[model samples]
Target chain A: MRNNDGNLVFERTPYISGYASVVGKKEGEGPLRDYYDRIIHDSYAGKDTFEQAESELMNTAVRVALNKGEFTQHDIDLACCGDLLNQCVASSFAMRSYAIPYAGVYGACSTMALSMILSATAIESGAAKRAVCAASSHYCTAERQYRFPLEYGSQRPPTAQWTVTGSGACILEKAGDSHNLLNHHTELKSNIPPSSGDDPLLKENHRESQTPYLHSARLGRIIDFQITDQNNMGAAMAPAVVKIGIKNNGIKHGIKP
Target chain B: MRNNDGNLVFERTPYISGYASVVGKKEGEGPLRDYYDRIIHDSYAGKDTFEQAESELMNTAVRVALNKGEFTQHDIDLACCGDLLNQCVASSFAMRSYAIPYAGVYGACSTMALSMILSATAIESGAAKRAVCAASSHYCTAERQYRFPLEYGSQRPPTAQWTVTGSGACILEKAGDSHNLLNHHTELKSNIPPSSGDDPLLKENHRESQTPYLHSARLGRIIDFQITDQNNMGAAMAPAVVKIGIKNNGIKHGIKP
Candidate 1:
């Protein structure tokens, strides 16, 4: 349902049934490394080109997510995916192996959020029974395409942000249907190596009531501060995020901001 | 609603309220040029870069479409746009001036159809009241990014396809809402110079009964024939098109293909 402030409150909330993530060596060494399902030690991930490596990363994530959900590509109604590459080649190439209907999306740094929102909307609207969403960005590919190549050894500005060579995918299904599926398939398997002993999905309560559900989504409007510095994308995007946050807060409290 | 064959059949159909197109000089010389609302004589479109020129083309088309629909950006619930540029920069940059919630999509040659389908689904689901969908491509931009720079004077193969420098935008609204708005605003103005004396929107019957409405949309699955020749994209894409066509025909005749 559309709210007065333009937020969409889904009467039939869609829930995330399964998810998986893969990261590069640099990201594997970070603090949140244990949360990822797989980590590739090689930058190329056995691929000749960085572009191909990114596609492989996305493909692996999608496959693992499907395995975690105990559903194959034939069960999915649609796939929404994107990447930072030109024309979103990584996503297009990765999705080619799967016969599911697809929609390619682009939102730069916010691609993950964008894909999830679209997937949720599709499920909530009864347009699809299940949807898979994925997004990826490779440091080597992004650096050369959007900035100076790594081979050039260009000096980085303090404000410049590093792009992660990583991919994440999730399977979203209707809440009611997710419960039925969980009851039918009790033997869950992790396609990738488990990062820790406390895998959340393994917990008894987690399978019962802890699966995350999407309540509502507030789409963002484009806001520009006229910042010309390409190195300072954070500044260009902060204002828009702030605007959405304030509006969301106002809506929660039933007050006009 | 989801069909047995994965096609979406909208019970509450969405109708096109307005649309406009802009083309480059080369396209203006074509036979169907009169259908376009405006044509840019300059290759750069008075912009400093070819990328910006493409963005300008898309922005102009969007504005003209809104004007024809007798609506403003505030009336739109969402904007779905995409282009051939890396990271979809053309669409992202073009949509920044508007405050409408935006979703950037990418589907290579099928971006236009993809955007329209998503928009129709959003309106049909009641997630959005109105939507604006657009797609754009520039000859110079695509030539340099995807193949070779124009300055290189590269030779073309027989199977190579020339990318058109053009943009089109359309406004979609709920079928019931469109009739109400059309009745309220009877005097519609064309934002760009009229190419011919017979403007379709100007006809009385056109406004009353001839407007187009979306009935159903079948999303496409990615298909690869393993043809690695970049110059022969038609060969790579034709098989997928034929598969969808055959499936659609079978569905129409109530026979399984």
Candidate 2:
């Protein structure tokens, strides 16, 4: 695919074959709570520290994702992981038990998307047959690292986005795989049924991901816009997200593309 | 490619098209000092905080690498970065100025290798035409974040590795580009002449990087042998490095492959 601004063009597209997610009590109580695979009753998840809880969450998510994909630790070709920790210790420590090749990434709240894009890129290129992309965020851990400790009981702020305790893992497989996992009504809400073994896209025999393929993406540029209020993450991230939307959707002013 | 353990072997290898390095005054005194491109007199790098200085080091390294590869931020499909600081502030702050789609990664001291491998994987996948991998380490920042403040002047043990200030950036293009840069021995001693039209790797290739390809790699597993010696990085990292050598070079025990 080509674009007027030369963005959103891809050489090879890939697919999201399998995915799993684990969330904390707060997140499970939220709007899309029904979609979560595992919802812990407490933030600690029976761990001693918030950090440890986050790590356990990630491990469980990864395990669920692997099981969903019908893969074992040894089958993970690439591991993209991160957390909101100072050095992403939660994800790193959780990966200790696995023999998967790993790439530890950091993107604050954007980490989920960052890991997904990278996983897609690797599978798209054929460097990896299966890539597990994961990220976790714990409210207590985030507070201790980025702000004040919850022990302080700081005053409420409406603009602050709650850092719900949650961990999500998604598996991306080689695009040519027969299953075409994205067709299911998962996060993206596509309802395409299983392949009949006679689909035209599959028949073409090109090395492209099946329906719901990951197309060329417009890499986001950091646009600070000098927003000093860090509490308002949506404001800070709006510019980049809008840029991506424009590039990918090519929405013209006052009109949808 | 499949191993006895089932690690996904890549069928398409990528190339290391270009690379650049920058070090602080202390590291300029090290053994491989001659290979570094720029050596700052101090860690401050004309910034108020050591943190900012570290960010500047990354920016300088990125610029140097971009110069060697003849690429602008526009050409980069993705930027993978990491540092030792909390949330990888050094690299993240540096990337604020570039338009490259970014993935901030963290692996403590192993960040450099982690970034390189991730970059190679992305480029090898063909999801990206070009990827920039970079990492930075500053003694002051590392000391403050991981252990103690530099002012503490804590007692040193033999196992403690000095945190020298340095940053490196490498550009990875699609594996088949003709420059075959790795074949040119800049640091390895010989200065291969610039590309000539007659070079075979350069011919019949629309977009293959020159020689010195990132042929293959084994993603390292986190092997915690219960060694609590934080300073003894060599022992903690030795197993993973050896595994990589055995996998990549096919070296055998008691005999070189």
Candidate 3:
């Protein structure tokens, strides 16, 4: 999982069992579409005619988290998540379904980062052996609550940005010396999912580049506890790119290139 | 409003602009049922499809509060209410209809008492001039979330109580000087409304008495402060009747009458 930089790198352990995501798509649409549609339909328990979509999105995140592991609702010690909406509805209501002891968190755009940090701490401190951290946002839903809606067709300046239109959930287990095997009981050999016709890498790279500082803060380690340094920053490097590119080209022209 | 005992008392305030309530019925169900219904349905923005019976119950309580004129939302700078259900959907969602900013609170039976104490402190500290504290417990809804449904006919012990099926909203205003003309617009009307032809009081005895206390460590002649102490302890007391009842009844009667 590590790059050549000799720095610590993290990866999803292959031994972790059971991962499934419920998605809806018309054709050539992104996974976010399924999340967006569900927000309009149901939050949890498959009930319709409910108005708040925020609750549904969080439920989906939790559902995805639960399905990916052997742990059931009873096994969960705590659940945590955050959202961009003014009220922390996503995290609070999601816990309703699991009925596991939980706490709601608020960290705005930095929510995912906050949840991950807390989740790691919980596992490390033995407060919880397994913890789930999730975060979700819908551009249309959050905008309506926090700002103008897309239907408003408002103009945007260079400073204006779009909110991420997806939710993510992760399950963290305390790493131990003993190996735990992942079991797949199904024998029918379900299709290997055809490697998804679309490219996930492209989408992630495009989105991550938009908020490089957030990405780095989310993925990086501390140089010191007091301050964060976003090395190989994405969005932060956008402005200086052209100047660096031109300078490099000029140097190359004077040399071998 | 102040009683001869020098304690501030709150009358229920309904959503209706002006109306009185009949006892034994819901608050807004008197002459202004139509008006009150509109507010309830609109308050949650049709997000929660309350049963006709439930809607009627909510309206009745609002009607009672409105008719009493013992409180006004305008007089309230803060509000707190919640129930046994997850996420406190009833109280928090109901708040969107009103412009007053509020914090929804949760504590099984202690919700109302806790809100009153919190609200009183906000006003006494000069942080706010008025406040509202509300609580509602819907038996059917709460049963589904917290325990077996009525269909289960589950056996219960004497210590268990059915969740109350009513919502109550109260407004607390800072007392004004007798000559202060500004008091007229906010003063609680003296007329008391009847509670008939409205939603039945699920249980009339559910209304517990609350005694307001202002604990001050220093000599400040504030309403709830005692003069004997030398510390400025700025806090209000909403009676812990249930807590006190247990001790007082046991000590005085040695058993229940």
Candidate 4:
């Protein structure tokens, strides 16, 4: 149901049963390197073009997520995907091999979040039993498309942030079904206590506490503060983030503003 | 709910309450010129750039649709929009002024159909009370981005289809609520017979017969026939459409193919 703050409260919470992340060489060298599932040392990821490389990254992420969840492509009801490309060709190309139904979304920097929300809604509304959400971006593609080409050797602005060459994907399923789906995965099965017998309720409760569930989502409105400087996108987006953060906080605390 | 054929059947039907279309000078001179709500004689539409002109076209379509339905910006729960530009900047720029929650989608040529299906799902699932779906494309933008620049005066292939410069917007609402929403519009009100009187049931049935309702939707999977020729997109896409069309036809006829 929609609250006064315009947030959607899911009646049937969606759970992230599996997830995977893949990054390029630069990001693999970062502090969060160990968190990723795979790292491609080459910028091209053995692909002919930067766009194809990005598509490969996303394809790897999706495959890894499905493997972790012990689910096949046919198990997924929908695939909500997008990327930072001229026409989001990365997602389309990556998903072409899989026969899963697809919906392509474009939200630039917010694409991953957007895809997750759409997936959660699909699961919550009974429109989908399981959905995959994925997003990808490559630094080389972004630089040449939005700025000077790498061969140009242009000077960088201090305020400009480097785009990461990476992709992440997650498999969302109905909350109640998580226990049955994740039972075969030994790592997750280890979370269940030996003393807790086959009482389904207790096991479900234990699994619920261990797994992450999406309870609600609040969609953001476009808030343009008119910061025309492309180099300082952080500053331009700050106001929008702050506005949404305040509204979300208010809704959580039951404070009307 | 999903059926054996992978189509979503909406239990609560969604209705198209209002719609509008806007086109540029070239389309205005076409045979269907009288069908459009508005036509701009200038390619720029008083905007400084072709990109901005495309945004203006989408903005006009959205406003005209909302105006016909007598809906203010606040009445819209969500706006699903996209375009042919890089990063879909045309949609983003056009939606920046409206405070309605937004979801940017990218399906290239299938964007409008994708948006409408999403809006229908949202309405049927009670995630949104009303949604505005809009899509736009400018010939100049498409030509410069995907092919040669307009100034180049490049030759065109015989198989190439010219991208029309236009925008279309539609508002989807709950089916039962359409009678109340369209009551103020005389054009639709005249559809009801004067003898119907105040019998609410008869009025509703009459309205249902006159209006269009979304019964079901089938999402398509990406199919690559590996046709590398850019000028013959129709040939590349024909197999996918035929496959989906046959499946839908089978479902309608209750065939278990």
Candidate 5:
């Protein structure tokens, strides 16, 4: 993590507080606890559409950033955020509160990661000083907008993860220690050879294995970063990740269960 | 324009079409021209907000891109667009119609330029081959949400530009050489003086000047791409054409105005 001193850089790990969520529009004792004291619940409840709710959520994130950072509107150099909306209305509406120079970005659920990436780039490029990167997924909101609604009772597979109706926001400060954004690394594992020598040359092996012989002939490829399944994100992404990682690392066998 | 055969590179020039505006509850005819056949009427009429209109307009743009580019639902690599809203609702909602992979972007009114920049980057990075970059602004919608009602008729300074309530979308294809995104040379003129020219005589001369002058005695500084008076982007952008023409071995700036 390199701080550009004048702009926001990425942070691998930083102190996090004020997490909030609007899943199912939960009213009490839920993910929105962090927002209970500061935010007005009715502010979001009165809206008729998901778009309105998204805008409200983004504004809430900005308010949180301002409060947690102990900085006023003037101190912020840029507001960077985006989501899966038609024209990035959530971000644009949120920016209305303050006149901070801004840039909106998108990358699906990967938006958070992409924001961090661009925040790092902008900081490294010295175009900004302090930046905020945030994203949200409103279940009731996203569902009605993206797929079938909750009322539709659409059957989903166990492999699929629930779409989280929540928002996450973080601030990247330029004056922090060097390890803000994690460095990009490229490395991979080697293929493991079959344990048995010459495949035993047995008549049973000659039969081409009537039984599916468990071959531990390959090592699973791994990425360096701490990998946590982002629930549905994992399954939706597993195929692509496995394909790339296995090929790049020279992993000889198929993906492990 | 160099075509790498479906490989996304940079373009040389492209035409813009299908522009429309909806200021307040009234629709403007400027955008409903040869290119535009659809008009997005607000559902709630006066109650129709910027977030909603912007989404509708962007959706129209995507539809236009789909029809004009002869692309199917799956053919679009990504949807890249953004607006002046707080949370980017416009791009997100508009993206729901097409099941194409998408990435929202924002740079305010400069959003077209910004999205174009990212589209170029995405194409160049091999992350996408075909990308659609679009942006929209709703003056009445923005005013009601951000500032005050347009009926208030507040006096704005000459430097202030009335936000145009319109949307524009462009489909960037790795196709024919005739259709390319052009690059223009940027220049800036500032009323700042050179540091090296600061001297005792210059300082005395500066004090005697009618207009505010620095000790360096310079009229202005010429920068490569910092367009000042950007409050009027159309006017400020004029010089770029001349500069680009000269740089690209086209007609020179034969006579200065």
Candidate 6:
């Protein structure tokens, strides 16, 4: 087992096999636009309110990621995820329909990283065979809760960021030795015939590609330089982000930042 | 390596070595009154605002728990804790004075349980030598955020329980076996002399009492039964709490609920 203790990086044996991103039309119009699995026409996505729409994004994103991984809902051991909602209603409400176990986390905009770290550790420690890390945020929902209501039409300050209306999910499966990054979860029996058998997905011709590995994860500690500016979250998150990036860089690539 | 996988209970070896709670005057006069270690004169705790008072309570609780454990700040690896505050500012701001790492968490009223579980798991997994699990809530802080300000004096239905202005913390130490519940952290050595030596604290006559072990921890999945009553958090939380208690009972004692 990889040592996942007493350090920033959770060096675990988890392979990120499949992923999906569901974005709003505005995000679909942006760069890296073609990469998203699906994009809805509006923020509401036919829901009555922005919160419902956010939940829809999360639910759809999970399904899309599962489809990409060729795994069904029953195959996933748990959904370790969160969002920007108070009480994390977006993820919790979406989870009521899902039969799998759930773990709701909160880390503001950095919640996805937190989810990924938790899933990796859980899977590494044999708490799960597979886990889905998901997060979502809608412009309307976040604005009204954290700042001004849509009806107020408050002007955005220069440091203000437009809350992205999008959701992303990724399936992390337990991995094995370094020589075989393609090693899947032991419990998840494979469909790949044999190393020598006729299978184009794993054939010698298609073996050039790489499996995305969770080399290590640097869990972030809370940090604040006392920037009490309510309008500028960037200032508050800057120190923590910088610390994470520096530590992760050193762990992942033997270089001290 | 006790198995903490798939099952709700984290059957780790952590003993709840120490704990501390600080509450406002109103809570001090209530049911769990005798349980808390310290009760402030007012909600503000002589601070300028309710937020500051809440932070002071958290900071004081950590110190109290540490003192009870006879461990200093440097001995703690992390503080796995949070509060009902937005962005978990109460926990984060309170932790800044201590040099140890902080893990901010949120589970509404169930935050204390979350803090305990996380600290236990981290300790069992060897991520921490010593951990402090903490949580707090002030009536004024939560009321204004989730409902009306205190000045409004909104009439409450019987079902609407008053938000307790209180904070609680616990120190979970890894237990070696059934016999070693009182064994402290490895780093916290030398303070305790041998049982056969000249220390009256560990004399045979005074060894009857046992420290309660955290036999297991069951993480509760979110269960929203479509009751969207903002004022009735008790209603929203009842299902989750019941689910947790039943599962924990089964896992810890095999009594099927």
| Interface RMSD score of each model | 1.3, 3.3, 19.5, 1.6, 13.0, 3.0
In candidate 4, list every pair of residues with a backbone clash: none
DockQ rank order:
1, 4, 2, 6, 5, 3
Which candidate comes out best when scored by TM-score?
4
What tens digits encode model 4's per-residue C-alpha lDDT throughout B23-113?
9999999999999999998999999989999999999999999999888888898899999898999999999888888899987788998
lDDT per residue, candidate 4, A1-257, as tens digits?
A: 33345677665556788899999999999999999999999999998999999999999999999999888998898999999898999999999988898999998888998898888777655578789999999999988877877879998887788998999999998655654444433344334332223335544654655866665677787888888876667788777777775655555758665
How would you encode candidate 5's per-residue C-alpha lDDT over A84-153 as one tens digit per residue?
A: 6644656666565665545677556667755654543333323334556777666666665565666789
Q: What is the interface root-mean-square deviation of candidate 4?
A: 1.6
Candidate 4 lDDT for residue B247: 61
Give the worst 10-residue stretch by lDDT in candidate 5 chain B: B214-223
Off by over 4 Å in 3: A1-28, A31-51, A150-160, A177-257, B1-257
Worst window of 10 by summed lDDT in candidate 6 chain B: B190-199
Q: What is the TM-score of each predicted model, taking all chains together?
A: 0.87, 0.82, 0.33, 0.88, 0.41, 0.82
Report the lDDT of model 3 for residue B166. Answer: 56
Cα distance off (Å), candidate 1, residue A207? 10
Return the clash pairs for model 1, or none.
none
Clashes of each: 0, 9, 29, 0, 45, 1
Instruction: Give each prediction's DockQ, rounded to 2 decimals.
Output: 0.56, 0.48, 0.01, 0.55, 0.10, 0.27
Better of 4 and 5 by DockQ: 4
- Assess each prediction's global lDDT (C-alpha) against the native: 0.80, 0.71, 0.41, 0.80, 0.48, 0.70
For model 1, residues B45-95, the per-residue Cα lDDT tens digits are 999999999999999999999999888898899899999988888888899
- List where candidate 5 sits over 4 angstroms from the true fold: A1-44, A150-160, A176-236, A243-257, B1-109, B116-257
lDDT (tens digit, per residue) of candidate 2 on B163-194: 87989998876544424344432222232122
Instruction: Please report the TM-score between candidate 3 and the true structure.
Output: 0.33
lDDT of 6 by residue, A1-257 (tens): 23234353333446676789999988999998999999997878899999999999999999898888888877777687778887687887777777666767777887887777667666544456678889999989989978888889888888787888999999887543223244432222333222212233333322444656554555566676888766787888888766756664455557776
